[model samples]
Target: MAWYMNSVEDLAELYNRVKEKNIPIERVSDHGHAIGIYIHDPDGNGIELSYEMPASEWGHDPSGYMIGGTAKGRLSGPWDEALARQAQVTA
Candidate 1:
């Protein structure tokens, strides 16, 4: 149902482009381990584009499997910076 993206840069780029084109973005979210950008299709189905924290940054179990809970929070990062830059550009 969600989590599809490679990097924050890619997410920011897509988001900015969408906004520039006046397309509606459903929402954005910062889940401790990842950043998610949500959008809706013409059909009204929701899609999530996200950038996940690298494995090296994640907590690992004794056997080396990554384990942890994602903290739900506000949207942030390169995405926020992107919005700011757009504001400056349009102003």
Candidate 2:
């Protein structure tokens, strides 16, 4: 189960809200141009919330299929939250 978000900032906001509500997030990761949040539903079904970077930032193979790389540096937590807030303000 998964849902795609529009931007990293959107994902950040969702993450903050979910945390505020005491929802347990299993994990968070960055997959190149995208970020993913893994969580479980009340029924214990796995769910993933994803946010992809803009098309301009995406990498493509020769055949034009999108390619993703492993995350570099931190993907979530206070630093990301601060960045997300700044992005929101700028946007």
Model 1 segments beyond 4 Å from truth? Answer: 1-3, 59-78, 81-91
The digit string of per-residue lDDT tens for model 1 on 2-85 reads 756677677778777777887777665666677877788788888887888776766677897656636443336656654455
Task: Report how far off residue 15 is in candidate 2 (Å).
Answer: 0.4
Candidate 2 error regions (>4 Å): 59-91
lDDT of 1 at 10: 76
Lowest-sum lDDT 10-residue window in model 1: 69-78
TM-score result, candidate 2:
0.65
Q: Report the Cα lDDT for residue 85, model 1.
A: 58
Compute the lDDT for candidate 2. Answer: 0.69
Q: CA lDDT of each candidate?
A: 0.68, 0.69
TM-score per candidate, chains pooled: 0.61, 0.65
Report the C-alpha lDDT of model 2 over 19-88, residue by residue, as the tens digit.
Answer: 8888887766656667777889999999998787666567677787766544443345433654455457
